[model samples]
Target: MSKSLTYTLLFLIMMIWGFNVIAIKILVESFAPVTITALRILLAGIVVMLILGIRKEFRKVTKPQLIYITIGALTGILGHHFFLSVGLTGTNASNAGLILGLVPLMTALAAILFLGDKLTILRMIGIVSGLIGVSFIVLNGERSVGSISRGDLYIFLAVVTQAVSFIAIKRATETMDARLMTGWMQIVGAFFLFVVSSRLEPDGLSTLTTGTPVDWIVFLASAILATGIGHMVYNKAIHQIGAGETAIFINLTPFFSLTGSYLFLGERIMVEQLFGFLFIVAGVLLGTGALEQSLRKHKQKRMAS
Candidate 1:
């Protein structure tokens, strides 16, 4: 594909992921975090299964892969989204969006620690700096803020769970079909979420009925468009352009989320949050070696010229 088309598609995927935060915030206004996350994952899993069946891609799993998928469900879906869903209750969607920019760096750190990946001085610095940034923004320069609202802390921990899941997923997908693995993981995660939410929330799935049409619209849009379609297109883009090039677009997610939140929710952020977010973004770029890669290309072009 042309670079232009590739970038467009990539940005579109990021946009979906970014704006989904707003959708989640809307859902949280009425629905419990676990309830929305539960229903969303379950519905999205069903959608993915249907698509997989239509494409003749759905298949049975082995015993070992099942265990791996179960682990993935726990870390990726159960713990990750559960924390994120609950976290949004106390935090602004825009700041939560920015927190996601730490994924690349956190994922890199996870790989280094768990997968025996090497880390360099520059990358380490990036990781440390990124941590400081996340702390600054999440803490908002007040140690008391941590007590006032755990939304930031919950969201930060959600990323940690997600990063850990990436390692498990990497190991599991070595022999498994990526699509099948993802679909099954969602199914498993959704099942657990359903059970947990049903038990904890006395309403027991009544949240769906209690909501208005607009709520339903937002819920379905988030599940189908943001989670399902977004995942498919992102995986496709990664295959097309390679993971390295694809990652550059993810940084745009926070910007899109910020814009959407401001327009739709009339949300505003503190200057400290922006600074911390930039620190996280810069750290991610540096730790992932994306910054160095860009600089190398620019230098090469300059010398050639």
Candidate 2:
């Protein structure tokens, strides 16, 4: 696996993820948000389980690991997906894509608060920048006060929940394989989502059968390619190249998502959204220490020279 090939694969994975937002938007047009999300997650979990079985990686989790995995399942899978699917119903995919770029910064904040990670000056700046960037998207260049939409608020909540889940995921992965944890989390999350959807959306399951062939295709691709295989490849890239290198690629996701929204859904991109993306890129670089690491390497090379 050459670096070039690995990078290309990562880029494609990001594209899949970006287009998945568009797929969700399309699916929500005909299916209930919670119902479709639950079904997709359930399918993704089964796919992951198949992969784990092929690799013979299944094992019993300790009580502590189970606790963390449960937390991750609830926050990352159940909470995040619920909000994101519902959010896309009330808002366009383009806005959701841009707003999700705040995940890295929010994760940084979560680490500082829950994991006792140090808050450096750069991180502080990054936090402010990311928040401002997301606010721009939420406001969508409107001059009127209170322009924030409910969907935008839900998207932000999704980011927050996912960020918190990262903390538990980190803990769980210390004593367990990430793939295993992910598989279990998805299964557990899907169960809860089913329960929730049944209570809130009595006709949700029936709506699944009402989708066209195209809708089913998009839904399957989003679940299998984006959620199932995408996660596996991403984790593999982290193992091969390192987490920092892999994380830098995440900055490309919003752009890919924006492009997908434009091409597939015919959504318009606003100037403010582009500007917000710039802030988000800068924030992720700073917030995730990618910028700091690059500077350190440069300084080291200069001293050696």
Candidate 3:
């Protein structure tokens, strides 16, 4: 794909994901979080499988790739979704969106620790800024003064699990296609979610039947557009453009999430949250090397001129 088209596609994908946070928040008001997550992920997995079947791109996984893929399924799919769903029960969608902005910073650190990537001074500064930004969001919860919110903590855990999952996914996709890995990971993760929901939420399955038509529409759209095809396109971007470049676009997600939350969920945007977002944007640009790369390109262009 041309660079402009690739960027445009990624921008749209981020918008879909941003709105997905609102979708989940709305769904959790009626359905049990874990149960709903299980159903959504299962449907998304089915969508991916159908796509793979139509394209004839499904391939058998070797033993080593299976190990990494399984790890990714557990952490990325099951763990991340589990925490995020539960977290949204207590936190506003606005806060949850800002907390998720930590993923790129955390993922960069994970790459350094797990993948033998270099740690630069800029990255160190970015990491500190990101953590400070998240602290503002977490501590500014709707509770007692200076007390951290449990919901914020769960969202942070979700970020941690997702970062770790990226490491496993990076390894798994070394030889395997990213789409195949995503399909298997989501399917396996959905299975585990089902088991967990069955154990902890015995009445959860019944709630699904009670949803209104509008609720079901939102649910299906979140599953199909946000989780299924969104992830597939994101993984493809990571494959084609490299992880660092792909991650820079993630900075756009929280802004979209903030807008969606304000418009759809009627959530207020706090000043502290806005400050947190500014720090996060700077951190991601620096952490992902996008700022450095941009400067380098501009300098080269100036010299050429």
Candidate 4:
């Protein structure tokens, strides 16, 4: 595929993810957080399983692969959703978007710690800045400036789970098929959530029966567009080009998410929050070594001019 087309598709996918955050905040008005997250995971898992089964890629799993899948089910699926659903219930959708901007940075830090990836001086500074920025946002209360309510703590927890999951995924992708692992992880996570929700939330069983038409549409969109198909297309894009090329598009996710929140959900941007976001983003770029490449590109453009 041409570069332009690849980028266009990635852009569309990020838009879906961006819009998904807003959609969840809206849907939470009608559904419990646990209920929504469990249902979404279950539905997405079923869809991915059918697709993989049709492609004959759903091979019998080995014991080791099952272990990895189980770990991912715990961290990536169960922990991440629990944090995210609760976080969105009390936080600003825009805040969730900005805080999630830490994924690349957190993943890079995890890589350095666990995978022996290089951690440069700049990246160290970036890490510190990210810490300070996230702290400021999470520690501040609702009446405080640039505060995103106390729910920001849940978002940070979600980031921690995601960063850890990235490590698990890196190990799995070394030998296992990424899509299959993801599918199984989803199934495992969904089962965990279903059982837990059944116990914790009184009306969890009636989640489907309780939603209106709009809620169901939003729920399906969140499951299919933002997650199930989103991850599939993401992996395919990485296969077509490379992880780095695909990753530069991640910078767009926050922008799209914040914009969607602002336009659709009427979220207002805060200066302090924006600064914190920039700090976090800078940390991600520098920590991941993508900043150097960006600088090199700018220098080339200047020399060309």
Question: What is the Cα-based lDDT of residue 181 in candidate 3?
Answer: 92
In angstroms, give how far residue 131 of model 1 lies from its true place: 1.4
Query: Which stretches in model 3 have alpha-carbon errors above 4 Å?
Result: 141-146, 296-305
In angstroms, the error of model 4 at 15 is 1.1
Ranking by TM-score: 2, 3, 1, 4
* Candidate 4 per-residue C-alpha lDDT over 1-305 given as tens digits, one digit per residue, 9 for 90 to 100: 78788888899998888788888788766787887788899888888888899998887778877887888899998898888888888888888887887887888888899889887898898788887767655554446545546578888889889888878877877787788878888889999987878878978667667888988899999998887988878877877877656666776777777788889988887766667777777677777767766787799999999
- The number of residue pairs in model 1 that clash at the backbone is 0
The TM-score between candidate 4 and the true structure equals 0.90
Residue pairs clashing in model 2 are none
Q: Write the per-residue lDDT of candidate 1 for residues 52-137, one digit (tens) a residue.
A: 89999888889999998999899989988988898999898987888877877888899899988778887888898888887777
Error of 3 at 94 (Å): 0.3
Q: Which lDDT values do the candidates have, in the order given?
A: 0.82, 0.88, 0.89, 0.80
- Cand. 2 Cα-lDDT: 0.88
Candidate 3: worst 10 consecutive residues by lDDT? Answer: 138-147
Model 3 lDDT on a 0 to 1 scale: 0.89
Error of 3 at 174 (Å): 0.5
Provide TM-scores for the models: 0.92, 0.96, 0.95, 0.90
